[model samples]
Target: MKKPAKILTTAMIMLFSLVQMPLTQAAMITTGEAIQAQQRNIDRDNLLSMLQKDELRAQLAAYGVDAQAAAERISHMTDAEIAMLNDHLDEMPAGESFLSVIGLIVVVLVVTDLIGATDVFPFIRPVS
Candidate 1:
């Protein structure tokens, strides 16, 4: 009983000695910057949700691209890529041409394939 108590006390002491407090950081952000950041997230969400459209999925299927894979690829896209896509989408008139959207998706997928993020395309060889 005494030995067990000694071991328990030693374990408690070691645990307390090894415990550490996490550090937190805070910074001031300008309103424009905050708005821009929020917009970026919204753009990314829009693009991801766009992949859920049945028409888009059929189009991707016609191109031999998997809808799920394309969605996964979009989720990994950078903020700049998302913004560029959003800008292109905004410029296009509604029901005018979905080709532009498909083109952009192909471009992003190809880029991701080349960078080793995905293997959707057969021709593009990922960098070693």
Candidate 2:
């Protein structure tokens, strides 16, 4: 009877050890990989949030456009157009600097005329 009880206890111990082995092996995987996977998930969530924001979608819709299409078009725009868009993005809608902006535009037009690239402004004629 004593021998049978000891054998049963030993078998139980072996079974418990076998069950724990895989859990220990699983923990040995690198923590960095886990963190990187979590960050990728978070970035995906943030991208979805930006795409689904109602205000942004409404602004894009006001132009008879879809937000994703507008974003794609802006991404593929020429550098000059991108710069203009950036400037527009930086402006406050209710701010009053129209005259200053108009003056700067006039100066640019004059310079372009002087350089003979444009002929729209007649005050400065390009040299032949």
Measured by lDDT, the strongest candidate is 1
TM-score to native of every candidate shown: 0.74, 0.30
RMSD of each: 5.1, 17.7
State the local distance difference test value for candidate 2. 0.53
For model 2, give the RMSD to the true fold: 17.7
What stretches of model 1 exceed 4 Å from their correct place? Answer: 1-23
Q: Name the candidate that leads on TM-score.
A: 1
Candidate 2 residue lDDT tens string, 1-128 = 99999999999999999987755433465889788667555544443354466765664455344556444443444445444533643473544433333333344445556878655445568976
Runs in model 2 lying further than 4 Å from the true structure: 1-52, 93-128
Worst 10 residues of 1 by lDDT: 16-25
How many pairs of residues collide in model 2?
Answer: 0
